[model samples]
Target: MDKKHLQTPSQTIGPFFAYGLTPTQYDYEFKSWVDNNMVADIDAPETIEISGTVFDGEGQAIDDAMVELWQDDGEHKLYGRFGTGTEENNRFIFKTIKPKSVNGQAPFINVILFMRGQLLHTYTRIYFADESSLNASDKVLNSVDAKRRNTLIAEKVGQKYSIDIHMQGQKETVFFDL
Candidate 1:
């Protein structure tokens, strides 16, 4: 007779990330390693604010989600993390500089979402709506259906950008598999 080993069950990604990764947001004693501010100099010419809400399948705002942003413009590489529970109306905001096109690719910010029901975090990209030319030529952007492309582009509102992420439903965001 031989003994067999069993694999442990996978747990859903969640509220734990909000407590550990976004300590300050949850009123923890210590600060998080990464914060919503990605720029070292707040007054940088390209500095901009990205704000949005994370909605659930029912189209209700999720107050406990954690969002992470990553950008590399061949010059500046920055990362920012935010928890929706800290903000009013469950919005996540990131203060970062606009990324520049690298190797002919359209300038975009990579986003990762971790929510209570997800077994693993989802990945997406935020393309600037103003970068029409570059966006039209971007391989990754073009790969998505023309109608669904809007789901990935962040709209310019006043001096900042805004984009809502819908976890499900008709307006669901385009998440990529890695």
Candidate 2:
């Protein structure tokens, strides 16, 4: 059998993306949201609870690791124009609304993987199932086999969505090198 190499969270020894270390663009809004009681009521019945485990290639849990996500709000752009952008952190809960594709384009959500020591900043893109038809039509996603394409999607569990990331190991999925 072929050896499957994997990296544990603790094994990450390089520079990890530092979050909350500095105030980001959304920080102001988030702060104001919290201060003015504008933050979304996550506990509301309408709110979705998106939570999951961050594992390494070895399937080890990475505690305290932050997952940042950005997607459209079922609004105008296939990708929403409301996100904080690259300069600002886009750390958000998974409970956001399911976005719609535009012009036959499946909306892609941007993700950033962050931890304590590993400086490796990986950017991952995810698409919605509603846009699976678009996935079948996307130049990039269609280039790959269906099995591999399915891996890029996050499973929706009731109101919660979950996507587990394996940083390094055999069969590791390549994340965007942001």
Q: Write one digit per residue (lDDT tens) for candidate 1, span 1-178.
A: 5788786765666566766788876889877788999996445776799999999999899988889999988788899998899788989999999988999999999999888888878999999999999999999998998888999999998779999999898889999986
Task: Please give the lDDT score at residue 145 for candidate 1.
Answer: 88
lDDT of each: 0.89, 0.50
Segments of candidate 2 deviating more than 4 angstroms:
1-49, 73-93, 143-147
RMSD of 1: 4.1
Displacement of residue 178 (Cα, Å) in model 1 is 2.0
What's the lDDT for candidate 1? Answer: 0.89
